[model samples]
Every structure is written in C-alpha cells, then in structure tokens.
Target: MSSKLFLGHRLRRLRRDHQMSQTDMATSLAISPSYLNHLERNQRPVTATLLLKLAEHYDVDVRAFAAGGGTRTGPDELAEIFSDHLLADLGVPRYELAELAHNSPSVADAVARLYAALKEAGRNPSLASNDDARSVVTPENWVRDYIQQHRNHYPELEEAAETLGGALSDPLSMQEPMRKRLKNAWGITTRVVSQSELGNISQQFDAERQLFLISSQLRPENRTFALAYQLALVEFAGVIDRMVAEAGAPDEGIRQLLHMSLANYAAGAIMMPYGRFLQACEEMRYSIDRLCGEFGANVEQVAHRLTTLSRPGARGVPFFMLRVDPAGNISKRYAGDQFPFSRFGGTCPRWNLHAAFQAAGQVVTQLIETPDGHRYFTVARTIERPIKSDLSGGLLAIGLGCDIVFAHKLHCAEAYDLADAPVTPVGPACSICPRLDCGYRATPPAGRMLAVDRNAKSISPYPFLP
Candidate 1:
C-alpha cells in the first residue's frame, strides 16, 4: 500500500493564498470545518478522495500536494545548513530540517543567508591566515551562479553572432570564413599545430607573431569552433567585457573565465544562428544527432547549444545541462529549468547520466521523477575530449533534460508512453534522499538515525528509525 500523504503546510499555504478561511475551504471541499482543521494541523492524513476534490474545486496542480510544491529550499540545501559546525551541537534530525524547509521557508531562507554571511566573514584574508579560515568561494562557483542567474541566455551575444553569421556565405562550414576574417580583420594567421607543439592547451594565440594555433588532435568541427571562439574574443571583446562587469566578477581570474564562457557562447551562436536554429529545432523536434549532422557540430556541442535557446520572443523548451566525469564530479552545469543540483556531493547514482558511462559513445534516454515528484525527460551520452597522443585525455558524460511537459515535442519521447511511462526515481544526492527503502542508497540520509537491529535485518543496508 502507498504511504499516507501529510501535506498540511502546503494545504494551509494554498488556503491562505486563495484568501479562504478554514470554514470556507471546508465548504468548498464538502467537508466539515473540524475535519479541515484536523487536516491543516496534520492530525489527519490527506485522503485520495479529498485530494481529488481539492484539485477539482480549487484548480490547483495535484503535484503541489504530492511534492510540497511551495517549498523553495531543497532538502539537500537544508541538510548542508544543519550539518554546519556552527549548528552541529544542536543534533537536529533530518526529518525536522525537511519540515522546517517545507513548513516555514522564510525561516529556512534567513538561516541560509546568515550561514552565507558567516562563511563570507570566515573567508576574510585579513582576519586569519589559517587554512580553515580560507574562503570557500571560487571562480567556478561565482561563474556558475552568474550563469544560473541569467538562465543561460545572452541576447546581446546572440545578436552579435547573428550579425556575424549573416556576413558569412556559409555559417555551418565556418573554417574558411573564420580564417579569412581573422586574417583580414585582425591580421592574425591561423594554423593547425601538432599535439607536441600545443601541449596541454587546445588553442593558443601568439600575440607577437599574430598567429592563432589549434591542436591537430581536435576534430574538424572542434577546430572550427576554436577558430570561431578566437574570432569572438577579438571582435566581441567589448561585449564580453561589459557582460563580465555586469556580473561583478570577484577577480581577474573569474573575469577571464567569464570572458572565455561568453566567447564560447558566441561561437555556438555563430555556428547555429539563433533564428535558424530555433526553426530547425521545431522542424526536427529537437533531434540531437540530426541537428549535429545538419550543423556540422558534435553531439556535446549540439546539446550545449540547445540549452541556450531561451531568447525572449523565440524561446524553445528550457533545458538543464550537466556534464560529469567517470568519477561523477560535475564539471559543467547550467540550469534553465530550476533543476536542483546537489552542491554538497555527487548527483544521485540512479540517474542515467552515470549509467551512460557504462555504454560509452551511445545515447541513453530515461524518464526520471525526483523525490519532489517533478518529472523530466533526460538524454545522456558520453563525449570524448581531444587527445594529442595515445594517452587518453578525458571522457565525460553529458546529460540534457527538460520538464516532462515538453516531452511531446522531443524525438526521443516518441518511443515512450508520455502519459504512462515508468519513471526512475532519483534525488539530488544520497545525502538528502528521503526514500527510506531505496536499495541503491550509498549513505544514510542527513538528520536520520540509523536503526541497527542485530536480530532482524532489513533489505535496506541502513534502515532508519521510524
């Protein structure tokens, strides 16, 4: 049998948002006021019949109750906050932390803000020289936040790329045009160099020689991208600098990283002009492989470009992209759909993104449902980085997903039953997953006490106390 649902806080919030008193809500749902009060207090579990009635009468999504939709803070963030050394002495349980986040989000936000301030203060270089006092904030985190805040879309860069693309006779085949433009516009000569000459760097510009060198190990498409990226740096330097200034980068390193990201964005835009790409997406139903073939780009490049189609007037489906190495370390992430990515640890092991590593160089698709009951259609594939020698450089798995509401518009979804497909349950991370009976859980969830029964063993390795 299914567990009873206790969404008292969510129901109460909904009632208040609708400006309805307990009696009014009870009357609308055809229930007694006393019964409604009991439900509001969580004394009585929500019944399936009442849930349907509430949805039917109030015109609210049923998921709002199933997932505690009003909760703004994720369970992982709460676990991290409560696990801090400052709060460790309190010994609060994970369930209680989850309750606080769901029932009183404002309090959770205040706590998080205070913790951030404490961390910031601890990072002050003048305050201390100890390693513990060192700042946790890095250029990666700052750049990630900046990109997330912008929803991974830059219209100014898109417009610049569109203009540049229009000037070219063939945008897909960008090698010749990029080379000519680099030489004519900037007096720079482009050349393909051996791996021994390039070393660790994929592309390098020698300012004194006015020469742009690319690693010969890179595929033709990647070499083209390198050239286009260099062109973007030279031509769109002012635009990229303005964007970095607006982001308020912490230091020169972060500013340079942001400039590189903007230059990459410009390169993608140049390869696939925004207007043409959006039309092609609609026509092809967002087929990655076909798009790659059509645009003369690689699978990873095509997937990354899809996430940047958030232009105001011509928006495509909003996607969340994640790239992880074999060790499950997140190397690149961009959230366009507010997808919760664990900040404390690796993503859930059950996600197909990890499974895709087993079948390298192949596309894998899965329908996934998070603990919050939000469903997504995920596509995962392994991408190999260019290597100069026989020694393999690195291989990473890229996952691109969107909310299930857009499943019908995707070619991958054609093989599945959109309405009744079986979804694999996953979470942000094992540290915050609330699924008590999950056999694949690697660690006990935060705030829960493990019940070690010497006499009777359960299927779950770390069964928690009820």
Candidate 2:
C-alpha cells in the first residue's frame, strides 16, 4: 500500500482535455518544465506534495491522483511478453518493462501484437526459418482469435438454436424430441452400434442410407450430446456455414474445426434453451450440480454451457470456463468475461483447480485474486473420460469462475464470507507471477535477476535482486 503514485496516463489525459501545454501547466504549478515532462512520462513518481498542488491548482479531486489509474496492460502481461525466448538474452529489468507499459502504452501494444504474430508463425513448419514470412498467419490461429475476440458468444447461433428448440416438445430433454425431429423432419435414423462395428469413429452419418451411427461405448449423456450435435449440423448448417464464410477461414481444416465448434455451441443452446436455462440458473443460485441434474446433462456440459449465456437482454452471470488435464495442460477455454489466462504456459499451481484432481469427482471452491487486484470466485471438479477397450480413460479438471461482484448469487460461495474471506493470490502462470513469498512458486519471475546465495540460505530458492 505504498502511497507513491504513477498517474502519468491520467495526467496526460487531463492536460490534453484542458488543452494546456506542459510549459503552461509547469509555470502555474511553480515547477520546471523538464520536471513536469518527467512526471507526465512516468520517469518520476508523483509525490504527495505535487499531488496536493495539482489538486488545488486544477480544482480536481485528490483521489484522482491515487495509484492504479495508469496503464491498460497489467504488469503480469508485460512480464509474460518480456519472458519470450526471443527477448530472454536482453536481460531487461521488470520495473523498466512496467514503466515502458505505463509510459509508452502504444509501443507496448505493438510489441504484444508482434509477439503474437511471431508465436503464430512459429507454429508452422514452413515459416520457422523465414523471418520475412513471419507475418503470414495460420487459419487455425485466426479462427481461435476470432472466437476469443467474440468472447465465445454468438447471438445468431443462439437465436437459431432457440428457433429450432421451439419446434421440439421439450428442449431440455432434447434426446427423444431431437430424435423424433431428425427422423420426421430430415428422414434420418439414428442407431447405437457397438464399438467394433463403428470402427474408430465415435459418430458417423451415411447420406445414401439416411442413417446416423453412434458408438455404444459412449456414456448416456455423451450419446445424447452426440445426437444433439448431429442434429445441429444438419439443421443449422446454413448458419454455421455463413459464420465460417464471414470469418474467411483459409483452409478446409480450419473451416471444419470452426463448424464443429459452432455445432457444439448450437447443441449446448438446444440442450439448455437460453431463456429456460437463465431462469433455472437464477432459481438454483447458479449451482452447477443442480443445473446438471435438472437439465439431464453432465457437469462438464453444464459448465461449458454456463460460459455461453451471454444473450442480450436475457443474460445470465458472466463466467469463464477452462479445462486442464492432470499434467497442467490447458485443453479448452472459453471466457465470457475478461479473465486473463496464460496463453503459452501452465496456469498458476496455487489455484484449487489443480487440487481438484486429488479429490476426484468432488467440487472445490476458492476465492482468488489476481495480481491486478481483481477477485473471482471459482469452482472446480474432475471429469472422467469414457474408457474404450484397451485404451485407458483420462481425467480433466474443469474450472468455472465469475467476478467477485457476482459471487454472492452463486451457491458455491454460500459457506464462505464474501466480505472477509481470505483470498488466494493467483497469477496467470509461474513465469510472470510477481508474488515473491509464495511457497509453491516453481520459478523466478521473468525479467528479474535471481540472487542465489550458497553460504546464506533463505526460504525462497531464488531471491530477486532489488
């Protein structure tokens, strides 16, 4: 809680709004022009004396001079950017990078954009050696960026699914109704076949015979979901095609992946028709287990559908969902809000999501705060994948969270005191986390020089140089 302030961006905005030159403002405040320039550029902090002077001279609120009103990019983001292997040899200091982000935001943004482009290019084998061709982007990354930019919600797909749901007798119990609709509307028959008969495919459709085949090894919920997904593909193909066309996906592979994702989205919408699901969520206090039981869906499906409740005028709680294996590898992510997630590295191990694996199939809840001071209420549980013959089944942990402002409405937060709860400070990843005192930290924060002492030992393995 240091009182030292860094309000350079705010001060620059104020001066520009009033159309006052730095020299004029410096003369009015009785400070040198160079000193004023330094303050505006974040080269020097705004001291308490200068803060009072600005408040009195400009007739503004003193609270405006408080810290935390400067940069849009957080220190963790800058840390991650500077930690890139390409810039590792530079050995830049963390405070310097923070200053660059606060003082020169546009330059910081350009660096971020360039880094993203390079990472995307580095994924392709052909572009690895061509520096000039690094600008060429991949269609898979383009589609992922498109989904992220849209916040994982598509109103058009929701509307289409709702319209289709209207034709069914019961949209929530969509298995039987969807089956009837497929048979009557599209003249397609669905059959549950043995794994040996179905070969390697989990699902297949025969156009000539007008038959849909699903492997019998899938769990009942998965079987139903597969059926719903197939119905979406057949019924909402036009809508999915239009979205993919508008996205301008370059390759057929990317197009197919986009189509599959859109189909899954539509299937979720159909299973939990937006309006009914929103009402159920409100009544149940956002309990995933209750929603699953009521809707006849599994926990994973319930959590995934929670992130898609972003319809306008009838929106539910904004949630972020992520799936990671026991090894800490992220398999799926969908954010309906601005929850910063690590893009290239493992998530913070301090999060209870990783601990959910120890108590498999049980839900764990936690109150976590990011380095930027935003707090969230998260619940996690482990999901078991279906086993197939000689292949072993795997487990993935699913985490669902919402901002702390909306925590009181969730059933998971009932046992804890929202106002007095002890929050676990978590970061996007270990590489960028600035929490020096965390006992479980595996690596020193990027851009900081580690001070290792052989003769004199401390609790932390790598004490950062001041």
Candidate 3:
C-alpha cells in the first residue's frame, strides 16, 4: 500500500528487456530521461501512479515485488546471512545488504543459497558431494530453496491435486479413495505392512510387483499422505519432471529430492484442495483441529497446509510453520511472512516452542515480539517425531504463527485480548540475539565484545558490551 519501494533494478531490467533506452521509456511514460534515470538508479522511490502505469504499459505484476516475489532473497535474509560468525569479521553494512537485495537480487539469492550450502555441508559432511565440478549446495538445501523460492505453492501441482481431490468421494476417509484410485486407475495395489517387513522404512514401492506398501506403525494421516503421494507421482509424473527441469537442478540427486518434495507438496494439496480448504478454513476460523477433522489430516499436516494458502485472490492468513526438537534443531520451516527465522542456528531459548514438549499433543499459544518490534501470534504443539531431527521417533514440536495483525483470524487467538495481551520478547538465537539482560543467553551477540569483569558479573552467562 505504501510507495516506499526501491524496485529500480526491476524497472531498468524491464526497459532493457523491452529494448528501450531511458529516453524512450521516459517519453513513453511522459517523463524526462533524467527522472527515469533517478528511478532506474534507485535514487528516487517510485510513486503509486507510476507503478500502475508501468504495470499497465510494461505488463509487470507490481504485486510480485511487493509480495517478496521474483527472487528468493530479501534484505532481512541478506542481513542474517552476513551475520554468521564466518562472515561477521567482514562487517558488511546494513545498507549494502539492502542495495544488494534491491539492485542485484539474483546475485543476493545465490549468495544466500551458497551460504546455506556451506552451513549444511558443515553440519553433514557425509551428505556433501565430493565432486569438485558439482555445485557446493547440497541437494536438500537446493531443493528446499527451490520450494522456498516459490513460497511452497505450485500452481500446476495445485491444479493437478484439485483434479485428484475432485475424484475423492469422502474427505473424512481419504485412504480408501486414494488406495482405490491407485489400484483401479494405475493398477498399483496398496498394502499396510509391519515396520519389520518394510525394514524400518515408512513406505516402499516394488516396481516389479506393482505394490505400494506402507508401514503399519505410520500414522493414519501419514498413510493417507503416502497414498496421495503415490497417486501424485503416477498421475503427474511428467509435470513434476518438467518442474524439476525448469528449476535447473544441478544433479540427479537434487532432481530426485525435488521430485519427492514436489510430490509431497502435491499430496498435501490433494489432501486439502485450495478452494474447498480455504472456504473450510474461513468457516472454521482457521482452527487446526476442525480443519484436521474435516480434511482427515493431522495437526502438523493441517498446519503445514495452512502455509500454502497464499493463492492470489483467496489468500488466507500468512502463517509460518516451524518444527523443532528439544535439542533446538529446526527440521521443517515454511515462512509465509518475514518471520526472521535464523538460517543456521536454532531458535531462541525464550520462545515457547520448546516448552510445548511439556504437554504432548496440547496446543500452546503465545504472542511474541521480536527485537524488530514485530509481534506474532504463535501456536505450538508436540507431535510424534518419526523424523530425522530426532531418531527413534522421539519428542518433536512444531510452532505455527502469523503476524499479529492476522492473529484475530485464528481460532486459538480468540481467547486472548489481542490489544492488551501480554507479549513475550523473543529473539532469533542467542548467538545473534542482542538482548543483554536475558540470563538465558548461551552466547553473546555477533560482533560485540563481551563485557568481562573481575569483581562483578551480569545476569546473562555471556554478557557483552551494550
């Protein structure tokens, strides 16, 4: 709504792509070339009227830039990427990050992505590719960034899933229909087997026998999801391949990972179609439990699905979902809004996502204010792990949140006084958190000298210069 945008690079690119000089573009827009140069160089911000005119003449969707689209990187993410201890000594200025994000977004995104790969490689050496010619970014991070780049929404996948969802006679019982479709249409039989038979795997498809076997120990929601996943893979195989090809995946490993993740996304979409699910979400006031019941999805599934409701016209609350274990490892993340998520580090100790472990399966609510003074309404709950973040299906918790402005739309937020409610001050992580008074700080803020003293001590374990 505000005209405080610095999208000069985009305008310049548009003009260059159209093979028009500054003078020509300015003449077309009824402005002087000098003024156009100012806008192109980001010396002046574009006004609302100019933006609409550019959209009308050049056919640019101005909303893409406003919605943090066109590129995966943002100024905040650039700031966080440079805040790493590895680059802390460089002391990259804040305005430089802004300039990089605005002027050369593709380069900024590549930098952020490479930094992510470095972190992942440091974390898991076994997964890192030994080939020198190959990309440094891991397949996991590569595919994850691809999903994040699209905001975890694929229009083609959503449409295919809608067709799949239309074939479902009952949403309450999806396993039967998904199984029937897989068997009757694709001639792929579905069987629920024991974990031992599947060798501790959640699922296995025997191509020779045309069999899809799911572990009996797997949750009902997961079984349904697996079936939907299989159906997705079978029905829309070429579409997924084309998507992976378009993504420019470096290797077959990344392509396979993308295929799996995209199939999972499609499965989730099939389980919860866009229009029907969005209507149900509105009618039920975005209640996870009710949506779970209506869609036959688990809490995590419903919460994850909620993040994908970023469709243009029927946009729902822009929520971010985070899955973390007691050890502070973040396994899953979907940021619908700029939630200031730490890239390489764990969540802050002050956040109650970890506290959700105390009451397993019970949803806990909190209104947290970040150091940036942005308030978010968060709901956290514990779920059975069955995940790699914690081996042996140990304790794992997930937190779902949205900007405080949309908090009132949530069913859980109805119990709180949004205006007068007490808000907790939380940071990204102790290593980067600037809060000095907090005793729970495990490490000092980056680039700050610790205020060591012989005769006195501060409340924080890692006291630093203010």
TM-score (all chains, Cα) for each model = 0.76, 0.77, 0.88
RMSD of 1: 8.8
What digit string (tens of lDDT, one per residue) describes model 1 on residues 69-185?
Answer: 325454557777776556756887778987787667668755654565466556664544445422435557667656755667798999999889667637458789989999999
Q: Rank the candidates by TM-score, best first.
A: 3, 2, 1
Kindly report which residue stretches of model 3 are placed more than 4 angstroms away from their true locations once superposed.
1-3, 9-43, 50-64, 67-71, 124-136, 386-391
Which scores better on TM-score, 1 or 3?
3
Stretches off by above 4 angstroms in model 1 are 1-80, 83-135, 169-172
Candidate with best TM-score: 3
For all candidates in order, the CA lDDT equals 0.79, 0.77, 0.82
Clashing pairs in 2: none
Which is the winner by lDDT between candidate 1 and candidate 3?
3
Positional deviation of residue 455's Cα in model 3 after best superposition, in angstroms: 1.7
Model 2: what TM-score?
A: 0.77
lDDT for position 439 in model 2: 68
Highest lDDT scorer: 3
lDDT of 3 by residue, 1-466 (tens): 6448777887886797689999999998888999999998889888878978876776655565554554567776787778778888898998899889888877997898778877766776765766653456777667767877777778788888888797794936988988889989989999988777877578888989999998887777788888889999999999998888898888888888889998888989999998899999999999999998999888888888988887655677878899987887787888655556675578877788989998888989999998888899999999874323223658779999988888878889999999999999988767777787898887778877888786898788778888
Determine which window of 10 residues in candidate 1 has minimal summed lDDT.
127-136
